[model samples]
Target: MSPHDQHETPGIDLARLRPWFAEAVPQARAEALSATLITGGKSNLTYRLSDGGSSWILRRPPLGHVLATAHDMGREYAVMAALADLHAVDPDAVGLGGFGRPQSFLTRQVARWRKQLAASYTRDLPDAVTLHAALEERATAADAASRPGIVHGDFRLDNVLVDGDDRLRAVIDWEMATVGDPVTDLALMLLYTRLARLVGPEIAPTPPTSSARRRSSPGTRPAAAATSATWASTWASRPSSSPRSSRASTSATWADRPSAPASTASVAERSTWTWATVSSPKGGGQWVGPGQDRVLALIEEVGLSTFKTYVDGKSIYLRGGKRQTFAGAVPPMKPSALADFQRLAVKLEEMASTVPLDAPWSAPRAVEWDSTTFGQWLDANAATDEAKWLFTLAFTVIQGEDPHLSSLLLILFHIAGCGGIEHMISTTGGSQESRVVGGTQRISQEPAKRLGKRVVLSSPVTEIRRQDRGVLVKSERVTVRCKRVIVAMSPADAGRIRFTPHLPVRRATLQRRWHNGTESKLFAVYDKPFWRDAGFSGSAMTDLPVARFVVDNSPPDGSVGILLTFMGTAGSGPGLTWSDAVLDDPRARRDALLADLTKLFGPKAAHPVRHLEQDWAREPWISGRVSTRPPGLMTQYTDAVSRPVGRIHWAGTETATVYDGYLEGAVRAGERVAKEVGAAL
Candidate 1:
C-alpha cells in the first residue's frame, strides 16, 4: 500500500505466519491457522487467528503509522510479560524480606525528595531556599537517633483483611516497606487514626487476649507481623518534625543510536529513507562506561526510527487532532515546514553530538552551532525568510530569549527524540512535570516542616550587610548573622537588595542586564468543560496574535473548567502593545480575551462566568515566566551571573544548564547553588 492509502484490511498474513510461528513457538506448528481482521487504525492492527478449536492473538505494525520503540511488540509481549509473572511471585522468595540497609535507605529517600522537589521548581520559591538551608540540620537528624529495622512505608488498616472467624486473612502490598527507620512506619499508622477512613473492609476489634492477630500468609507472615507490632509498640508516643537534567539529566541520546539497516518493508518509516548502517560484529567494544551504556540503551529503548520523526508530514496532521486541514496561510506554511523539519532533524543531530550542552560556546564546532544568533541559524538553513519567521516566532514562545543560537538548539534537541514536532507544538494540557499541584506553595510545605519555627514567613530582608567574618541579614525588627547568604529570588528582585560594600562590576552588571520574558496567563473559568461534548480534546494552537496556545485545564472531578491562553513576550499574543495602562486594565484584558476565545471556541467561550488574568509583568516578586538575555548581553555576563561573590551566591531556573527556562531547571539550580554555599560555609 502507498503511504497515502487510507484503506486498510488489518488482516493477518496467514501464509507468512505458517513458518514464523512454527519457529517462535513449536507448540503452535500443528494448528492449521485462519485469521480475521479485528481492528486497525493509527495504533497496532489486530487479528484473531483460529484453528477451529482455539484461537491465538496476533498483533503487527499499523499500515502507515509506526512509532519506533514506542510500539515495540517484542518488549511488550516477550520481556515484560515474563518479568511481570516473576514479580507476581512471593517477595520473600526473592529475599525482599529483611532487606536491611538503614542509613543508606533513609539517606537516599531524603536525596530523592530533594531531587524531585528541585525538578518541580518551575517557578520561584524563596522559602524553599530558607527550608533547604536548614534541611541538613533537621531532615537527616531523625535517621541517626532511631533504631533501624524493617518498616512498612504505609501501614494502613485497609491493607489488611480479616475472615468471618476474626482470623488474619492476608497481609498484602509491601511496595513502600523496606529496611529503614521503623519509626516512620508507625508515624504513618498514627496519622491514619480514624478507623472509618480505612480503604479496606472493617475488621472486628481484636480481644485484648486474642493471639489470632498474629496469623498471616506465607512462611514469613507470622514473624513479619510480630516484628511490625513490636516496632509499633515502642512508637505510641513520639515527637515529629518535617519535611522536605543531566545535560538538561535524561539519558536519551540524539547524537548516538544503533546504526542499523531498515527492512525494505512498505511501512511509512522504512519505505523511503535509506538509514546508514554500521556493524559491530558479535562482540563490539564492550558497550563500555556508565554514560556510554546508558546512552546506547536509551537509544535502543526509544527505538532506531525515533530519529526519523520528520520523515513523514505527520507533524501537522497529528497536532491538528481532528482538524486535519489547515486554513488560510497555515496550509502554505505547512509545506515549507515539512521540508524544514527534515533538514532541521539532520542538522539537530549534528548539533546534539558536536555542541557542548552546558557551555555551547566551548564546543569545537562553536562557530557552527553557538557563535551565531538563533535568527542567523535559521536564515543559514532556511530556504525562505517566511520559514525563518515561522520557527523563530515559535521558538520565542518556547525559550523566552533569542540571544544565542544554542537556546534554539537546546529546545530543539530536547524535543528531537520526543517522536515528533506535534508534541512540542501542542503546548496545551500541561506536561508530566506539572504535577506540582499547589503551585509554588507546594515547594514550601516540606521546608516549613523541616525548618519549623526557624522559617520566618512574612519578614522581608531589608538589608544584607557584610560584618566581620559574617553577614548581617536585617529585616523588620530583626538582625541575624549568617556565614553565607544565597539570594534565590529573580535577578530583578535580587537587584532590589542593597549590597553595602557593593557587588563587583561584573556581578552588578549581570543583575541589571538579565531580563524576564513577558507572559500572561489568560485564565477563563467555566461551570463545566463544554468542549468535550463537541469532540475537542481541550488542546489547540494557532498563529493568531490573540492567543498562540489554548489549554483545557478542567478539574479532575469535573467541578469546573479552566482555559489558559497565553500572551507570550517578544511582542506576541493578544495584539496588545506594552502600554502600561492597557496591560494593567483587568476588564480590557478580560474582554479582549473573551472576544478572541469566541472566535476560536464559539459563543459559549464569550460567556465565561469568571475571567482571571495573571500577567507575570504585574506579579510582585516575578516579572516574567522566564529570564532571557538581550542580543549582546550573554557574552559579557554569562560567567558572572551564578558566580559566588564573597559569601553570596545566585540560584534560579535561568541559571540552569538543562531545561533552562523550565521548573526542573529552577530546582536543579537551587540544589547547585545550595551546594556551592554549603561548601563555602
Candidate 2:
C-alpha cells in the first residue's frame, strides 16, 4: 500500500489536548477555539487552532514510530518564544511569536496521522530514498553547534502564514523544533521547501533509516515511540508491492531516475506544475498544442539552437537531451541571457522600430502636496552623504555631455545648507570644504573621461580564440591577440566570444548575464533654474515608472540648465532616442512639456538651452541600463559571474558590488576584474 492509500489510525483526541492548552494558557478560556489539519509533510502532524480571536498553531510527531532527533516539540516552542521576545524590540530580526509547552494528547494525535501515511505506501519510491539519504548525509556532515535559540525542525511555507497585509503572521509546527544545530533547522526548512514542490503540499511521513530506528530502545518515551512508529509505517508502505501494469511500472521506473525527462506537457496530461518547463523550449512544444508547424516556427524565431547547450532552464536543452528543470531553483534565464535574447530580439525589434514610440499625451497630472509633510518625508528619506556621493557618481556619467552643471551646483548648495557636507566631514573627520570640492571635481571629470577613451567598440563579437599566453578579440576587426584580454563587456558579448577550447555554459552564462541591470535613465534638460526662484526644488513629485525619479539641475549661474529624469520601466528603452528636433518642434507631441515647465516655474523655463536625453537602448557599447536585478537571477548567478573564463576576464558596471550602475560600480568592476586577471597570473 502506498502511504497515500494507508488507512488512517485513530490517535489522541483534540478534546484531550484542549485541557493541557487551557491549563497552560490561562487566556484560552476567553478565546474561541477552532482546529483544522494542514496536510503534507512526513513525520509531523500540524494543526491550526484559533483561541477566541487569536490564531495559534500546534504540531506533533506523526502516529507510531519516529526518529529520536526528528520531532522535538519542546525545542520548537522554546525557540519561538525566545525569538518573539527579540522580535518585539527589533522588527528587522528574524523572529516568530508566542510558544507553548508540549501536549501529550496532541502528540498521540499526530502519531496516528504519521502511522496512516507510512502504512499507506504500497510501493517503494527510490527517489524518496535517495532524497532521504542525501538529507541525512548533509545533516551528519554539518557541524554540530548550537544556534541562537530554538530551531523549527519542519519549517516549511505551509507551516507559516501571511496575513492580508502580506506580513508573516505566524510560524507553526513544533514537532521537529530542537535546540541542537540551527543549521539543521535551516536545512530542514530547505528540505521542506523542496519536498513541497516535489510532493503535494501534504507530505507523507518518511521512514527513518535502519540505524535511526535501532538507536531507539524499548525505553523510548511515548513521543519517541510515536515518531518511530510513523517512520516505520511509512517505510512499510512502499509502492513496489502494488500490482502495477508494465507501462505504469515503466513510467514509475523512469520517474524514479532523477535524470529522466519530466513530461514537457500540460498539467492536464502530466499533472505536474513546474514553471521550468513552461519557460523552456521543450515546454514550448506543449504550448503550441499539437500545432507542429507553429511550434517549429516559434522555435526558429527564438533561435533555439543558440540555447541548446545552456543549462539552468535558460538553455533550451541540457546534456542527455533533457529539458532543463528550473522549478524551485532560479528562473531559467539570467540577465545576460535576456541581454543576448535582446541582441537577437533586435532583428525583430527593427521591423517594428519604424512605428512611432507611444507616450502619454495629456496635460501634466496635478498632485496635491502639503509642504510641511513633504519636507518631513524628504528629511526622513534623504540619502546620506555617502549615498549622495555614490548617487552623484552614478547619475553624472549617465548625464553625458548636456548635464545641468548649474543644477548640480544648486543641488550641492542645498546639500551643504542641509548640513549634508558637514555631517560627512564629521563622520569621516575630513575637511568639509575639501571633500565637497573634491567630490564636485570628480563628478565634473567623469563624463569627459568616459567619452574620451576611444576603443574599437565591437558588438555581437563572433569569437575570442584563446592561445596559450593570450586571447584574440575577433569581431569585424582583424584578430588582435594579447598576453591578456579584459572582457569588460556584457555577458552576452562574453558568451558569444568563442574560446580556443569552448568555455562551459556556466562560464558563458556568467559572462552574458553577469550584471543584469535593465533599468532606464532619462534626462530632461530645462532652459534655466526657474523652479528654484519659484520655491520649488528640482526634485519631482512621483514614484511611478517604478523607479521613476527626477532631480533638479537648474544651473547656479542662472544659465540654461537641465533636469535629469530616470524612468525605471523595462519597456521604457525607446525614450532614449528622443532628440532635440523631436522636442523642439512646436507641433511635436512633446512640446507641451516645455509649456508645463514654464507654467510650473516661469516663462524662462519654456525651452531648454538644449534638451539632451538618452535611454539605455541607444547605448551600443553598454547594453541595457545599469544592473537592476529581478528576483532570483542575482543569487543564482553571483558566483558564476565572479568566475573568470580562460585568459579572458570580465569588467563592466554590472559586475560591481559597491556602485553597480554608478561610476563607482565601474571602478569596482575594474578593480575586481584586475584582481581576477592578476590571480590567474
Candidate 3:
C-alpha cells in the first residue's frame, strides 16, 4: 500500500532492533532477546523486551502519519537516563526526596499540549478534532514558572510505578520526558489528577496514596527539602549537565516516606463486593444506540471561534463518543459575545488565581462573593434571566430555585476557559476509540496480571466491616482481610457498605446527599450510516424534552450504522420515559426515542433495525454513570468528599478536581488515592 494511504506506521522488527540496543548500551543484556508489544497507549508504540527474567520497556513514535509535535522518543530516553545510572553510579529522581516549583510546571505542559493538538487530527473523532482546532487559538498559557527543571512531558500515574513500601519504582515511558521546566512535571500530574477523577482512579495498580506524587503536589507536602543520604555520593560522579536538563538515577532513594496501618482487617469483613463481574446482556437481536446530529449541528453552528461567548447559541463537544462538559461560558452581554467570552476568561483566571483548590469555599473571593449558584455567578457578572440555558445544559435544573445553584470552584475547574481548556487537554481527551480495542476488561485484567494477582469474578462485596486493626471487605464469593481499603466505586454504591465504626459526620453527609443523575443511552443500529450521506457529522445537543446529547459510534469500515444518544437527568426532563416499564418492549422505547432523533436527523432516524440500551445507573458495582450536583450540595461538602479516614481512603470520579463526572476523573482519583494508600502502607 502507498505510505500516504497507510493509517499507521510500520511495526519495528527485532532484526532491526538487536543492533540498535547493542549500540545504545554495549554493556549488554541481549542474550536471546525477544520483544512483545504493549497495548493501551494513545499515540505511541511500546514493547517489552526481555532476556529471561528482567524486562525493559521500549517505546517509539506512532506507526501511522504523525504530527511533528506528537512524539519525541529521544527526549523521553534522555530524561530516564539522566535519572538512572549507566549500570554504574547514577542519580535517580525518586532519590531527590522532593520536588521544586510545581505551579510553573503545570503552565508549561498546557502550552506544549496545545501545540501538539493544533497540528494533529485523527480519523475517528473529527467533531472533537474540529472544536479543539479552534479552541487552541484562544488559550492564554499560565505564566507561573520560577526556573527550568527536569520535566516529564506526560507525567501521569500510569507512566510511573512504586514498590511495596511506596517508593518510586520507575518512571517509565520517557519518550515525552525532557529537561527545561521540571515544574511542568508537577503541573501535568495535577492536570492528570483533575482529568483522572472523571473516570475513577485514572492509574491502574498504583494506588492513589503513593508518596512520590504527594511530594509533587503543591499544597500537600514540601518539596526539595528532604535529602536521601546517597544523593550526593552517586549523582556527583555523573557527567555534568544542567540540574533541570540532565536526568536523575532511579535505583536508590532515602525511602523515608511515612508508613500505613500494620494489622490487616478482620476475616469476616474481607468478603467480596461483586462489582467487576456483571455479565454482558445476551441477545442476537442488536441493542440500538443513536446517531447524534443535534450535538454535531450545535458544534458546527456555534463555531468554536466564539462558542464560549454564547454567540452561536449552543455548543456541542464529543470525543469518538464521550461527552465532556457542554454549554456556554458567561451569559450574553451587550458589548458583543466575543468580548464577553474574553471577559469570562478574565473572571475564571481571577478565580484560578485567587481561589485555591484546597480551600475554595473559604477563599475570600467566594466567601465575600454574593453568588450561590453558577447561574447567580453569571447573572452577577451580567447574563440575563432567560440566558439560563448555559446552566440548564451544564448543571442540573432544580424546581422552585431560580438560576440553579452550583459550586463556583467546579465551574472554574471545568468550564472556565471552555475551548481554551479543551484545546489544552483535547489531545488526551476524546473517546479514544482506537485504544478501546481491548474492551472493559483492559482496565482490570492487565493491571492484575502485571501485579501477580488473579481477577476473581462473580463475587460482589456485601459489606466492609471496620475493625480495630483494619477493615473486613466481604462478598458472597470471598472475603479479604486488609489493613486499609480504597473504596473505588461510586459514592452511591460505597454508601451501601456497612461500616463498623460508620463514616464520619462529613463523610456520612456526603454519602447521604450524593446522587447520580439518571442517564439512559440508546443505540439505533442500521445497515448503513444514512445520516452521513446527507452532509451530517452525526453529533448533536438540544433542549428537547427527552433526549439531548447524540452521536454516531459507527464501525471504522462502516459495516453497520450506530447512532448513540442520551436522556434523563435526576429530578428533571420528561418522566413519560423509558425506565424499566419498557424494558421488555425495546421497540416501544426505540420508537419513542426515534421521534426525538427524527426531529434532529429527519424521518430516516426513526427507522432502525434494532436498539441498544445501557442503564449506567443500574450497573452492578457502579450504581451510576454520571455524578450530578443539584444546586447547593457540591460546595457544602466538597472538602470531605475524597479525604482519607484512618485506613480507609475514598476515590471515584466525583472526588476529582477536573471533569469530576467523567472517565478521566475516575483515573485521576484512583491514582491519587493509590499513592496516598501506598505511602501510608
* Top TM-score model: 1
Writing each residue's lDDT as its tens digit, candidate 1 over 535-560 gives: 55444455543555565665455467
Instruction: For residue 7, give model 2's deviation from the true position in Å.
Output: 99
Better of 2 and 3 by TM-score: 3
What is the Å distance of residue 1 in model 2 from its true position? 99
What are the Cα lDDT values of the candidates? 0.46, 0.36, 0.46
* Model 3 per-residue lDDT tens digits across residues 1-681: 322223322465665566666665455465445655555455556555555544545567778887565576554544444463322312234432232334445444456555566556455554354444332321212232144455556665565433345444444455554434554466566655544432222112233443223111111111111121100101212212223211111100001212211212322332332112111111111111112122223223333110110011233443223433333433223245446545655665667565555555565655434245555566567353323343344343111122233445555544432223323222123222122222332343344334322233333456666776665666543455566777665566667666767788888877777655555567878888787776565656555544555556675556788777665433432122334523333444555677767776778887777666665544434445455454445556657877887777777666766435444455566668768877976
TM-score for each of the candidates: 0.47, 0.32, 0.46
lDDT for 325 in candidate 3 is 34
lDDT of 2 by residue, 363-417 (tens): 0210111111212222343334322222332333232211112122212222222
Model 1 lowest lDDT segment of ten: 245-254
- Whole-model lDDT, candidate 1? 0.46
Arrange candidates by TM-score, descending: 1, 3, 2
| lDDT score, candidate 1, position 475 | 47
